[model samples]
Target: MDRITLAFWSLVIGLCGATAFFVTGIYGQQATQQQREAKLESGDLVQLVKVIDGDTVVVSKEGQPNATVRLLGIKTLESKHGKDEVAVYGRAAEEALKRLVGDKPLRVLLNTPPRDRHGRTIATLYAGDQDIGLGLISQGHALVYSVYPFASMPVYLQAQTTARANNLGLWGDPEVSAKAEAMINEWARQGS
Candidate 1:
């Protein structure tokens, strides 16, 4: 072949190889991401990265990026930017979650559609067989988030009722009780 023809063929082959490599890399990355999501959906245990609050956490598996998880079926008070009593209870709630999840692998039970409006994974975390959300509600460190229906809504509502009636954790303190009660009432109204 002449020099021009040979050079044209060489360049075409190189371009084709480059395109193939690019497409392969893209697909490989997508496969890896899908595998990570599937693992979460399968309720695999992941390491706890951080306890963001009572209702939120950061978690990850060996090869996946950290996922921000919103604990389903419950909500905790704001640990920041709230009234004094609320903030106090919020901080306590955060600590309670830390203790509950300390050094244990969390089993992630993802909700249907998996993510929420804020792009956080909506899941119920379990430390072994113990449901963390139920523990928090039962202890009065969190409240049942009844606006959205979940599998454990009835159990969580009952736990919250018992916690409130017995004056546990945040419910026990008069200063926090009034404020917490108001919030609970609001949630009840919204749910109704």
Candidate 2:
């Protein structure tokens, strides 16, 4: 073949390869997004082996490494901080979670993006017949935290509001007088 003709063909082939790569990359990204969405739609049953805190649990799924699950739509008080003391309600929250799900069977219903940045599974957890997040909020052991896209935000909020009105757990502590204020201050100081 002529030198110019060979050079022209090489350029054309390179452009084609580049286009293929770009197309594949786009398709790959789309496929990954779809897979993530699908995962969010499925629920997995796991054994709750460890209670990390009020809003986090570690579950063991068969044939898979233990998954750290962060409960959706709830925030518990901080149990530990670098230098700060544990928050007032922190122990209570942890205890409540432990009472609810520790060493028990749990169903983890994933939300979009199954895992969070810290490698925790973001899920709505169920223990037996109870929704774990709602149970925590209803008991006043945790607060409803409605960040964007948390699947159970409305239910969690309702549970928390009802708990507050009924003076459940922390809310029922008359000695504190301003129960919510006290809990918030403690949470802020300890940094959950």
Best by the lDDT measure: 1
- Error (Å) of candidate 2 at residue 101 is 1.5
Instruction: Count backbone overlaps in model 2.
Output: 0
Q: Which parts of model 1 have CA positions greater than 4 angstroms off?
A: 1-39
Worst 10 residues of 1 by lDDT: 33-42
**Local distance difference test, each candidate:** 0.86, 0.73
TM-score of each model, paired residue for residue: 0.77, 0.65
Checking candidate 2 for backbone clashes, the offending pairs are none
lDDT of 1 by residue, 1-192 (tens): 999999999999999999999999987886665455524665788888888888998888777677778999898989987767788889898999988888999998889878887667899999998899999999999988877889899899899999999999998999788877787788779978
lDDT of 2 by residue, 1-192 (tens): 999999999999999999999999987886565444323234677887777877887777776556667887777868765433335566788888888876667777877777776556688888887898899999988887644436567787788778889988766765532755665557556553
lDDT of 1: 0.86
**Quick one: best TM-score, which candidate?**
1
Candidate 1 lDDT at 87 equals 88
